[model samples]
Target: MYLAIATDGVELQQPERTNELYASYWERLGPDEITKLLAEHDAGELLPDFNHVMVPVATLRRLAAGRVPEGWDDDFAAMLAHAREKGWLSEDGEAVRAHLERER
Candidate 1:
């Protein structure tokens, strides 16, 4: 599952097939503003597994075009809990960490 912040709104897309992930990756590119905003970060943060980025939940909410999909609420909460335990969250718990796969 992935959250896409597009020109219209945020879309939660789940590919049926594993190879579909590649198609979804570049189907519709996000606005340059997204990269511009990310580039503003001077000190990059990393999690154990990947080049992780710590983004404020508030920011994600603001960028969100819609509510979380049904049945995903608990999963989202669990994700946060796991991040917190892994020290992937911010000191104040205002931001959550996400993997930075690559520059598009």
Candidate 2:
């Protein structure tokens, strides 16, 4: 399971779909743990596990353009770098809808 966060909101998701959202490291979390994380996010707490949150390419672009929430844990650069390293990012750092491209 992974926590998917975007400009819309957060959700607990299985990391299967490529273009659905950005996925983080695999962790078998219980429902209670998921709820706690969501609650913490709603309460504006900088998630201690913020690094586990993956920002989609679209959201990343918005973030770079100052169009999204700015209260993140200042891990944008690290996340972006990780994305690039993992081939989850486009050449220009924008959205890539195809999983094949993502794997390339």
Candidate 3:
């Protein structure tokens, strides 16, 4: 999932918004593997004026409100554990680090 951090605010970005998406990173998750951007990709520094912002992990869960299958709890938990180990979670352990990817 990708969260776009625009000049106005942070929100979940649609896949079609390919360019100028001041937002987060992407993940290629598989049964035994997960790949995502590096921590350096956290793009709050590229923000024009607002403070460094991060997309809350809670939001990610929200996105799963009606999309995931009936048995994804374990997978979700594993993802969270991985995020924690990488120090990608916010101090409260609620947000995930994002990246800056725009059309340059």
Best-matching candidate per TM-score? 3
- Candidate 2 residue lDDT tens string, 1-104: 23453334554454232233433323544444544554555411222444333234543343335333453324444555666777755587753322211111
Q: For residue 64, give model 2's deviation from the true position in Å.
A: 12
Q: Kindly report the root-mean-square deviation of model 1 from the true structure over all alpha carbons.
A: 7.4
Candidate 2 lDDT at 90 equals 59
For each candidate in turn, the TM-score is: 0.48, 0.29, 0.49
lDDT of 3 at 13: 44
Error of 1 at 90 (Å): 0.9
| Range of the 10 consecutive residues with the lowest summed lDDT in candidate 2 | 95-104
User: Candidate 2, after superposition: displacement of residue 15 in Å?
Assistant: 16
What lDDT would each prediction earn against the true structure? 0.45, 0.40, 0.46
Give a tens-digit lDDT track for model 3, residues 16-103.
Answer: 2222122542332221211122123332232232222455566656644666566556666666677677775568877765554533
Query: In candidate 3, how many Å is residue 2 off?
Result: 1.9
Q: Which order, best to worst by TM-score?
A: 3, 1, 2
Per-residue lDDT of model 1, residues 1-104, tens digit only: 34343334433355121111111123344335344334443212233453445556555444432554554545655666777888767888887766554426
